[model samples]
Target: YFFRDPERRPPDLPGAVVAPADGKIIDLSLVEAGPVHDSAARKVSIFMSPFNVHVNRIPVEGVVKALRYSPGKFAAAFQSKASLDNERQYVDFAGPYGRVGCVQIAGWLARRIVCHLRVGQAVHPGERYGMIRFGSRLDLYLPPECDIRVKLNDRVRAGETIVGVLHETK
Candidate 1:
């Protein structure tokens, strides 16, 4: 029962950006420059302990635009740099608001990362789209206008937690 796929309630907050995995929020910061589609962006990192649910969900409603898997070293996922140094897959989506994406980073004990999403497919918030074995992490990258709702060290449930809100001011 480690890979539980609990039925998650759809977020009631307008323009909600839900958590992509069940775990503790490890990092919440604005990326000034990085390889996540653009330069300035808001990022939310969730660390999935071996005991937490492993199923991953889409964070927002959009059309999948890109999917890139990078094979890298096995590192402790709690480190901030693990995002770039660890084996990971980047899944990005294009919607009315802007580009939103998530990364599935493999943990030290993680050997396989499974992503059920394909490029050009339509995705929705809280929808199960991928998974990773053992301890792992999920990082949500949002447009700068997206207001993050979750905080560092906060525990979040995939598909049910409102990690951020995408503003439609553009």
Candidate 2:
């Protein structure tokens, strides 16, 4: 149940950003320009309950530019601080329109983060790349130009929900 089936389908809309994990959207905010990416970006935090699927999916089709692992505290995933203090894996993908970043965060009940993609690897939207063993959070950092589709408390399905859309900039 922590992996994807061959028949599973993601949305077909162009430039759509899909949810990386199944859960309720706990937070949505604009992060100040930081080390994760050069420009300020929007963050979508999804809290995966014990009953939700633990598998993680790719938010867009792109080349994996980097995969970073950070060891930190096991705070509750739903808290805003958990995005910075919790043990996590950061995956950066260079999509056609812009860059997309996904962070797999370990919650209080989660002990491990499993990411299967490597730097330079090409991945498709909604493709299973890794998973957190149990309850956890998945944070998606989107480009500043993208329009967010989900709001706080919205329920989302991994690989099936359109969480945002990347608008083309000239």
Worst-scoring 10-residue span by lDDT in model 1 = 30-39
Off by over 4 Å in 2: 1-7
User: Candidate 1: lDDT of 152?
Assistant: 86
Q: How many clashes (backbone N, Cα, C below 3 Å) per candidate?
A: 0, 0
> Could you tell me the lDDT of residue 110 within candidate 2?
89
lDDT of 1: 0.86
Cα lDDT tens digits for candidate 2, 1-170: 54333434899999999999999999898988533578798888999988788889999978999889999999999998999999999998887768889999999998789999989998998899988988699999998778899999999998999999996545
Give the clashing pairs for model 2. none
Give the Cα-based TM-score of candidate 2 against the true structure. 0.94
Against the unseen true structure, what C-alpha lDDT does each candidate score?
A: 0.86, 0.88
In the range 61-156, model 1's lDDT, one tens digit per residue, is 889998999999888888888899999999988887688879999988886899988889998888899899876998888888787888889999
In TM-score terms, candidate 1 sits at 0.95
